[model samples]
Target chain A: MTSEQDPRPRAVIVACTDGPLLVRGEIDLISASGEAIPRTRKTVALCRCGVSTIKPFCDGSHKLVGFRTDPVPPADRKRDEGIVTGEEAPPDAERSGA
Target chain B: MVVCAGSQGVDDAPVRAHCVGMNAFDWARRSGGPPEILFDARGPLSAHLLDVLQRPVPESGEMLAALLPATEIALSQSVDVLRDDDIQLALFILYGLHYGQVLPADEDWEWNPSLITARLALEREFEKRLRSCVPMPALPEVDSDAVAGALFDLTAPDPGPSLSRYAAKRATPGQLLEFLVQRSIYTLKEADPHSWAIPRLTGRAKAAMVEIQADEYGGGLPERMHSTIFAGTMRHVGLDDRYGAYVDNVPALTLTSLNMMTMFGLNRRLRGAVAGHLAAFEMTSSIPNRLYGNGFRRLGYDTNVTWYFDEHVEADAVHEQIAGRDLAGSLAEDEPQLLSDIMFGASACLTIDGWVADDMLDAWSKGLSSLRVPLAVQSFATA
Candidate 1:
């Protein structure tokens, strides 16, 4: 895993169960108008609930609105099996494959 | 300035004399060296502790011996230790020793066995009171997803008396300044208390804490650190931005909020409590921050004055997600035994903070000052 030539993706995003999409690593966040959203922190949580006053970046409105994500299907859960279930997996393991 | 007097050197005369005409708030502003003792003794325990702290360590033995009795007296007389000005202030000073620079004392006193004994004495009661008083939510399964969902539900917005709503819609300019003063007790040293658990935590929880803290510390830019940003807001509004500058102004309950966090963060046994505390803290921050910013803006303050609140609206939004899931949730999953404490911590945050808010709104509703001492500086009149 420490090898310089490792094939794992550097930028990963975790679809936090029933919460925001937690994005870690270097990735440009752009708006639909193609304007670059100014990223200030190293990691950012993008709003998934669609009601966040601060678009792109979450403002914790998900909780207020009772936002819910559909349960992960067993078939899809299989593909991300070890990454999600492994105790030693990195915090951003959900999308490490991409 | 009065000189240290007496052979035994246990006398508080010099400190008291020095504070004669001037209050602690003024004395703190005048003294230039390491954060001068910014508050006065609320009762015998704090009086003795402050007196001992000012004198040299070698001469502290006699004064130190008086501490336990004084603490006992203060604790016994007080109906509620949490709201006891004397006990809370003494604990704040004791904890201040660990944080450094806040208490005026010998560096050697940080590890003083006597002080630690007194601190533990106070902490045992404080924690017990907290555990008894703070309504604990029902525990969720020992899984991250369940834990996060439960936390979210636990912190869901309530239709109740809210300090943020009052600030947004109806706070007078003076009330806003009072709000800032009440918050300064903790906001000036924001995140330092929680950072204590960095070493105590491991793996996913640790990673989540660092990630959240990095942003709080301004993501490598000292100018942007949340505390510094808050200080700027204080300065922008005509208040002193120095840490502890307003300690004397706030009531005991304000100090209790920060003291509770320090208690949780500093004790490894309470690591789960600290994590839950942070989750509850961040969870409740964002929306209220938006309201807080609106409050400032409503009062004709510019972006510079409101930036601190605005920053929280975005920053805490991200932090709450990470804190609830990756930090608090993960900790509960890994250490199933801590699940109860985790819920307890979250509940404690809401209950205690709710009390603080209620106190403020109560005062405002009565057209009174929330601060124990009203701010001397007038609010910057907006055009």
Candidate 2:
């Protein structure tokens, strides 16, 4: 067991069911143009919903926008308040290979 | 000088000056451990607790036995339990028995039936007040995603006149120190209050809590521990960084805030409330912490003084996700019966914290010091 060569610390990002892509492990986060983004903590929540005031970071805006990946009961989703239209944004920005 | 309701402040100055002799701060400085609390007993319950703390164990235990009934009576008659200085201080002191360095008493007092009697009496009233006043939001479905969604919506940062916003733009150096003093009551202890819930939690919820706690404890480096980092900021700004250094200065509501967390965390049954409290706490932390950091920078304090706030801005963003989806949400999914308490806990956090902020802002707006005893230090290293 000691002799086995360990692979690289693969950064695993969990696509949270209705929220951000929770990223952890050894990961290099860069901008679209390949600029290094400074990270303060080991784990981070990258905004899946585009509505976050803090871009590239989930300021927990998915909840504000009612961003859902799985089909919730329509009645629950249609409850009277705080759900912005999810259609104009990317279907799933993290999954869209950005 | 503290001018409470525009009272004559000079008479109390000498009394406050006397408060420094062998108090919590001096003990903290010497031992780097939870200091024996030396604040004046505000009323009978606290007086009994403090006196018992000074006696040897058997004697203290006997004293407590004699006093528990009186303490229970005092708690029962309290009209405003939340603001009653005596009950609040007594509760803070009892909770202190669990978290060392706050009390220099024997460890055996931690589970003494007599002490527990007083703590329970106070907690019953305190919890009743919280549940009565802090209206719980409608419960979300008992699923990870739904519970997380509910918590997030509940704790969404308010866009109104707030303490962070006020401090960011206009607070004087003295005001900033008052702000730090108010926060020091909890920040010095930092994540320990919620840590009680760790053993009570299971499965994904437990794993998630441990992960977040790992960061809170500074990812294996003691120097980077959030509590240690906060102490560094306090020292940078020329304030005492000792735990409970400013406890005597803080108001009843301030103690109530930490006591609430301790209550939720300590009780095994309130695991759901503790999780929800942590979730709401993290969800509401980042942005205001950014504003708080900005306020320090604006006042010419450098990163040394701002690191605590700056660290929270990003750290909590990460913690919010883990706390919401993984910890609190997973807990609800696993134990659906706790779903309502989860929502109630989140709402209580927001409600109590809102009161704390309101107390500070109102005091600041009125040109009054928010502290019970205004901090004596007035000068700061300026821009």
Candidate 3:
């Protein structure tokens, strides 16, 4: 287990079904061209390739380029939205007049 | 909650069974989910900020101790302060502390006087520079009714590429990604910047802001939360979705967009700007979102990929009216003195966003990458 005080920053990449990678944790995140940035935060997003107007973050650029290594159904995507909304609902059982 | 406006289902249900509400505009599809930080030795500026925030009276302390050098430089030059990427980045971090997106300097630092003094010092200049360029509308006699009208007048976007229109037609895959990256500064946190104004509002104005915000917040759904949906979009596209993940790539102008909103929302004196910003934001959202959806679909994306834009097409149609008339209008009616600031704030959103859009299109048009530097690929690369 790494302690939060560990001076060394290890970046983790979590994969989702739709767009860019979500990045968290301590990282220098220099550009591939090598510009040392001035920010020191616990989390930051970096662009996967040379795109992203928002730069270091993913803005669903893969879709624009047809970058498809992971192909998931649009249904799964809908369910994901449901999960996000459903969490706020007390319970599914409560919604229907059982 | 689900007012069926689009169509009815088999049981004569609303055709759009999907809530597909305002929360959709908040989502940005990224690729890699997000990373976790193991540990770190704090930077001097971030560390000092933490110390001050933890203090008993952060509202009156040395929040800018580590940043004095940069501050000195900002105080020295005119062209540098607004254009200097470093100064703007630093200022962005300092403000980020208060917004709760970045880690706190010290809990007490949230309101520390000296730290605020430092922030105020930077903001005084920042605001002056912003005001010089912001194009404030002429104020009518201060009254709630007059103020609202001014806000509506300001939100009418002047002719430009209509980035959304451009996105619908011309955006390449790379350009779309770049667009998302630029949007991350605000979308990752979604409605929070404007929520800062919630406490400052009263009666009808407060109610309107809350009504609009509630939809922005997915009406309490976590999955539906715009930020989370944006995170999903990030994962879909193979980018990082974590909050504050892309601070490095944003240029000063990009940071200024978010900073402007925070500046308006955070200050009680600028409540009108906050109202005006929201009004303008709502007014401008709809058609462009449709164009964005078309752009994604043109590239062969399924509804999942384009749903966020699709949702905005419907939601912001309703939101803009509420924001323009009820929120901004009512606030102006309640407090006419804020009219000019309200109009200025709306125009600021349009103006700053125009700069960001123009910068992106300019890069793409020139066959160039819009990011500060190209992302590294260990094996293969494109751009």
Candidate 4:
């Protein structure tokens, strides 16, 4: 498909063993202040903790602060189902068909 | 006006009110709240707002005028009131009435024809002024998918001192908390504003918005909800997290950012703008949030203080795609007419938000407070 016709969204989520999560390309980043970061050159990192030498991007701040993203237990984990089930009920009957 | 109408907190009310303007009964939310008399025509704006809202139907034009002085003023000025503190604050409050943030207005006014007329009239002027003042980015096509690309392009910030970069590197704890206070105006409301488009869209676009909003609402867990998470972050930093608690402390620029979103999301005609706005927003979020979290960490704050930013790092990475493709792209495919609007919305978000960020960073760089009233000026004893 041409770029315009492509419906599959693309993104890069890089997991760092001893540092911050490195992300690249089209992503939305709203700060705690509700401001959007204007587009940048397709690469960024997120600090897992408040402490990052890199400020906004993670420069291994989590390791210093001991941040952890423990994986959810098998049964409890929602398995990235691509959509949340039962969580979002439609508004009503009349507000259908857009 | 459907199942979701009742399933709301104060934040989501704007989404419900977006398609419709405030009616007489809806105006009651203004009474005895927030220092300023928000609506001021018949009684004080607040009192008249409540009086009209408690009624079952539309009030007279004079009554409507009392509750919507900002609207009247906006049309006459022809200047963008979206950033005017008085006008934006009042408009935000007016929209809040329809969202059912507090008690429901009188039942009869929910669909009052005359009240709707007044809202439409006000909105027309508000939008007209914005179009003239809010510079839009040059776009290639008016199609939905192309609109997404244009929006992405529009979100790019011009070179300078971005607040996130500064916060990460240099902000003091007190300064950081103050910044968070300005953000609380919208972050506390989180995804409710954008959710308004869910009912106004269909197919890919509708699904896309729901996909992103579901995460924003924190799936099923109330504590994990973005708004709830933000409140936790606020409490971590010793700021008040209750809704509208710090409304007075913020300046017009802060209020305008949200007013723009509400204005974009509430108007169905601007659905593409909402989508593009969201896309541009998400596309730019992940990195700065990381910096924000780190900035707090650098100040010796713990994970609790940074969870909001951390959460965005993960959530928005996923949301960016959902927003860009499913929401914006899908919308363009469904309604080709909105392509230019979508582009316009995204660019508007970037330009307006850039202006505010620059304002905050510039103030900090100059060693001045960014809030409307500086922190030192407010006496704790009286407050």
Question: What TM-score does each of the candidates earn?
Answer: 0.86, 0.82, 0.65, 0.66
lDDT of 4 at A83: 24
Evaluation by TM-score, superior candidate among 1 and 2: 1
How far does residue B116 in candidate 4 sit from its true spot (Å)? 3.9
- Name the runs in model 1 displaced over 4 angstroms: A1-4, A71-98, B1-36, B381-383
Report every candidate's CA lDDT.
Answer: 0.78, 0.75, 0.58, 0.60
lDDT of 1 by residue, B1-383 (tens): 22222111233434434432233335555665333565678888888999998887899888888888777777778899989988999999999989864655777899998899899999999999999999879889999888888987787765566778777778988888888878877887889999999999999999999999989999999888887788667666656655566778899998999899999999999999999988888888887887778889998899888989989988987888888888998999888899998899988888888888888889989988888888765455332
* B330 Cα displacement, candidate 3 (Å): 1.0
Model 3 regions more than 4 Å off: A1-98, B1-66, B78-80, B103-108, B140-150, B377-383
Report residue B169 deviation for candidate 3 (angstroms).
Answer: 1.0
- lDDT, residue B26, candidate 4: 36
Give Cα distance to truth, residue B196, candidate 3, Å. 0.6
Global CA lDDT computed for model 3: 0.58
DockQ values, each candidate: 0.15, 0.14, 0.01, 0.03
RMSD of each: 9.9, 7.6, 21.2, 14.4
Winner by TM-score: 1
Residue-level lDDT for A49 in candidate 4: 52
Interface RMSD list for the candidates? 12.2, 10.8, 18.1, 15.0
Taking the candidates one at a time, how many backbone clashes does each contain? 0, 2, 93, 29
Candidate 4: residue A81 lDDT (0-100): 33
Off by over 4 Å in 4: A1-98, B1-70, B77-79, B102-115, B141-147, B376-383
Error of 2 at B196 (Å): 0.4
